[model samples]
Target: MRGIVMAAPGDVRVEEREDPKILKPTDAIIRLTATCICGSDLWPYRGVERVNHTPMGHEYVGIVEEIGDEVTTLKVGDFVVGSFVISDNTCEICQSGYQSRCVHGEFVSQTIGTQAEKARIPYADGALVATPAHPDPELIPSLLAASDVLGTGWFAAVAAEAGPASNPHPDFAPRMRPVDYAARPLPSRSFDGAHSAGSLGVAVRRGARGGGGPGASGGSSGGGLR
Candidate 1:
């Protein structure tokens, strides 16, 4: 299958790669029909990290082609959407809807991300959500958003809302003193809510592109996980 590869910072390219094969007991290979770029992917592309030639995508919608013996709730030809964070969605954090911080979670390899013809998903029973059969193509982008960006951002927002930073103190940023872990986390929530919310704005923009009215362009009512 072909995928986007980043050999170094500012060196992203679409290239052919070896087809993925199962390497673990909990893996499921799926043939992706749709996938996308996440802003997080831009980090390494911008050289914030020393990343190279890793898989390039996380969000994916595909049909399962194979499964491991340990895998359940998934079978061949099953249409599915997977989370960017490799979560089993069964652990304590996952049960509380924190799949991104799963006890046994994993990240998709940078070189073999979701932007391909097929992908091998680990923790198949937990990492992916099955959708209705033959889903509408129009819903693809929305569903893809849920797989990673939406879920991760929501997790961040929820975390910030708890403890010293509740909704009541929405603007009450914590003072940054030495060891001020509390406030540090909340500001990151800025990215959390903003990133999640930013996409909704994009959806609204999509609506505007569809010729929706002025208020219809990339705002509260426009873009969000379908």
Candidate 2:
């Protein structure tokens, strides 16, 4: 298989590499259907972070090609989206909805780069979410986005306490329109109200320069600005 490797700051090349194999009992291997460069990938590309022949890319969606003995939740040919963070979801922290902070968690980008034909995924049961069926080719990009960008936006919305009851000023709605559209796959009604709260934060920050906008004068309360 071939993969992207950052030889140095501002230097990247696609080179032949050994095919990834399951190194742990909890691992799985996926043949990448789509992969993307994330904002964090720019850190090393721009010299802000060190890179010595480092593999690149983290966000991806792929078809499961193989699995380890411990990876019972998935099977061959499953279309899957994986988290950038590797974690065993059975951990106490994961049970509390903080899988990213799971005791055994690690960032995938640091070891396994997805910008290739195939890649190894650790903690497969916890880190990979399978779609109900094979997705259409057109939906691959959106599903790939869910691997990171959409998840980040969703987390941002949740942290902001966005919920169904929140009403955002119409003027700020456009700012969060992308998040709203990307969040369509999510089942939470809170996402509908999340757009308002997410945008309101921006509105409040800008309003600080002048006077706060209507309903943006106070901290978020019940997912709405007071």
Candidate 3:
């Protein structure tokens, strides 16, 4: 398989690599239908983060080419969408909807580059969600977006206290007051609103590029089994 490799800052190349294989009983090998770069990938690319000849990319949508014996929820040829962070799904953190912080976690980008023909997905049953059927070509973009950016943005909004009940009333204008400014809010002030959003658009635009994006485009991919 071939994947994006960062040999050095501003040096991204499509190079051949060893094919991904199932090394664990819970692992699954996916043949990517679509994979994208994340904004986080740019950090290493821009020399902001230190790395050497590392694999890049994370957001992906793929077909299950193979699965370990212990993978129960998915099968060969299944079209799947997995969280950026792989989790056992049954872990305490995962049960509570915080799979990214699972007791045992691994960074997907550090493990393998998703911007290739195939990838090895750990904790297959817990990490991946299959579509009801093979998706239409048009839906591929939406499904691929759900792999990371959209999901991350939703969590960011929730973490920022933008709950479901918070709806934007027309004629609302955003302003930064002394109190609001002094509060030292999270994410950013511009994104905290009823109808306002940021991370999703930014991440989507970043992911749409050949290289993920231009900041810390890497992070922990998923939680591990106990």
Candidate 4:
């Protein structure tokens, strides 16, 4: 398979590597159909984050090609979406709706980055949400966004206490994407700099109700923590 790998700061290359396989009972091997280089990948690309070598990418939407013996709920050809953090999803943290802090959490980039032909995903039963069917081509981008940025944005909105009564009208820079309202600049606000494009959606949902205006900002990273 070929994948984007950062050899060093400011250097990225698409190189050949061995394919991934199920290594554990809970693992599943996926043939990537779509993937994206997250905004965080720019950290290393721009030489801000120090690294000698690193696999790139995290957000992924793929078709399951194989599953471990213990895997259930998903089968070959299942199209799935998952968070950047692989988790058992049954842990205390996961039970509390904080899968990112799952006791058995693992960063996707730490093992099999998603920017490739294939990837081995751990906790398949708990980590991935399969789509009902092969999605419409037009919905692919939205589905892919749900895997990371969109999910992050939703979480951020919830954490920021954005509700129906909250107004999220922050003046954004001219170049900011309108759909990405969460990435806008705010006047005076302190928030965890972590969330996706979905944050603005949540804010809009809440703003439909009434009350204080909510403010959202995209995080430094796309999927996982910065």
Candidate 5:
């Protein structure tokens, strides 16, 4: 299948490579219907030393085409949405609603990302989430967004007390999406930056320091980490 590949810093190309197949008992192959470029993708697209030629996209909503022997919950032809950080969603962390930090969580198509027509999801049982049966067509966009960006944005707001979770109490958990007023453990105030890497930690910009506003924090200073 053809995928977006970052050959090196400052270069991106749509390339063809071998199609993925089941390699393990818990693996799955998906025929992606929706995927998009993430904001972080610019780091490599602008040549900031990603230094690998792997597949590119991650957020995906797709139809299952194949499943491994160990896969149980997912079946062929299931329409599903999977997180960018792939996890079994059944681990202690996942069970606690920290699916992004699943002990065995992973990101797909970094070099061979989800932007393509097909993808192989490893640890299928622990990673993918089935959308509601017979969802509305318009919901697909929101579902796809929930798979990553919206999830992250929503999570970010709660983590920083800007969304519904803004109780200002140290002991209360932050509210999460869909649930409206539901609270989860205090998420990092700064994901997408230092302290924690990947998609979990939010990073505050240097300039955000001058004012100390949450929005100012996540907004990049347009300067690389000092």
Candidate 6:
């Protein structure tokens, strides 16, 4: 299989690499259907971060090709979305909903590159979430966003206490995609509400700073403000 490798700062190549295999009981191999370049990828490309033959890409959506003995929650042919971080979601921190900080967590970008035909995922049961069924091709991009950006925005919104009553300013409307997708139940509305709340927080802050009108106060009770 061929995967992306960053040979050095400002240097990237698609090179032949050994196929990935299950390395642990909780591992799973996925044949990537779609992957996208994340903003962080530019760090190495722009020479701000060190790069020495590093595998690139972390955001992905794919079909399960194989699973290890311990991976019980998924089966072959399942369409799944995985987090950027590999985690054993049973840890106390994960139980608290911070799987990215799980006691046994690893960044997928640091080890496995999804920008290839297939890649092995560690802690498969914990890191991957299967869709109810194969999703529409058009929804693939939105599902892929759930892997990272959408998740981050949702978390930020939750931290800010954004909710249904919170009114996000129009200027921040473009940031409401999570909310729109959430309405369809493809992922969940909580992610949407939180993502909207997070964006509302930004709008509120700007309003408080005199950037917008007085209506920003409507979001204050929704925890859009500190």
Give one digit per residue, the lDDT tens place, for model 2 in 1-226.
9999999999999999999998999999999999998878888899988899998877888999999999988899999887776667676655544555567876667688988999999888877877778999998988776676554554444553355666543443555554363343233334322112222212212332453433333221112112
Worst 10 residues of 2 by lDDT: 193-202
Per-model clash counts, in order, read: 12, 0, 12, 10, 23, 0
lDDT of every predicted structure (CA atoms):
0.61, 0.67, 0.65, 0.65, 0.61, 0.67
**What is the clash count of model 3?**
12
Q: Residue-wise lDDT of candidate 5 within 95-190, one digit each (tens)?
A: 444556667766664533898889888877655665546367787777676566544654544453554434554433344443442333344332
Q: Please state the error at residue 140 of candidate 4 in Å.
A: 0.9
TM-score of each: 0.70, 0.73, 0.73, 0.75, 0.70, 0.73
Model 2 regions more than 4 Å off? 164-226
Query: Which segments of candidate 1 are over 4 A away from where they belong?
Result: 109-111, 160-185, 188-226
Supply the TM-score for candidate 6: 0.73
* Per-residue lDDT value at 203 in model 6: 30
State the lDDT of candidate 4 residue by residue for 17-136, as single tens digits.
788877898999998889987777777678877766687777888999999999987899998876677767566555555566567777676467888888888988766777778888
Model 1: per-residue lDDT, tens digit, 55-162? Answer: 688777889999998998878888887766576656665544444456776666453487778888888887766665768889888878766655444334334443
Report the CA-based lDDT of candidate 3 relative to the real structure. 0.65
Candidate 5 Cα RMSD after full superposition onto the native fold (Å): 10.9
Clashing pairs in model 2, backbone N/Cα/C closer than 3 A = none
Alpha-carbon RMSD of each model: 10.3, 11.9, 9.7, 7.4, 10.9, 11.5
Candidate 4 local accuracy as lDDT?
Answer: 0.65
Model 5 bad stretches (over 4 Å): 109-112, 134-137, 161-166, 169-189, 193-226
